[model samples]
Target: MVELQAATKLDAVFHALGDATRRHMLRDLAGGERSVGELAAPFEISLAAASKHIKALERAGLVRRTVAGRKHLCRLEARPLEGAHEWLGFYKQFWSGRLDILESLLRQEDAAKSQGEDHD
Candidate 1:
């Protein structure tokens, strides 16, 4: 089903996002495209390690890469993140509703307690 495939793809996106290094790379790409070397500059990782991270992002559909001769140019492909955001938005709404109910109950209980103290 399409939903299953979307969930599977979202799983890959979350796995890719689970790493701080890949997240930073995505943030860098958000500004515009950059060479693999440019993406790897801030970290102490070897080029190979950076490539592995980029490959993961590519697999998640979070980044697009193009080869220009010997250089690998990478750019953010953020559409997959929109899917992830949509998935999280469902839970956000669910929790927000639950918290709102909890806040109302607490406010009612506090008002009742104050009324009892005033009567005493």
Candidate 2:
């Protein structure tokens, strides 16, 4: 089991996802475990750069790497993802309220436009 870090795991997850390459790497890892070379092939960056991104993901607890013979295989660890879910859940009410307001305003505007067109 992954021990919860001092800083919220959500912080780690978001921090790890801040980079485009890392996010892509996660997407790839979702399918199955991959070697460093397979992960690096999709990006324009060098292998070293991709390795750095993988390192960040590793620190965040979003990825796990194991040595299989000579190759390092990367696997996605979803435990930290739960932290991300918890953090996002906090904003759900706010977004829902704002969306409701916007929807009402749009409906009002549409109603007004329809009535105006009827008068013409």
Which candidate ranks first by TM-score, i.e. highest? 1
What lDDT score belongs to each candidate, Candidate 1 first?
A: 0.97, 0.89
Q: Give each model a TM-score.
A: 0.92, 0.81
Model 1 misplacement above 4 A: none
lDDT of 1 by residue, 5-43 (tens): 988999999999999999999999999999999999999
In candidate 2, stretches whose alpha carbon ends up further than 4 angstroms from where it belongs are 1-6, 112-120
Indicate the worst ten consecutive residues by lDDT in candidate 2. 1-10
* Each prediction's RMSD to truth: 1.3, 3.3
lDDT of 2 at 73: 91
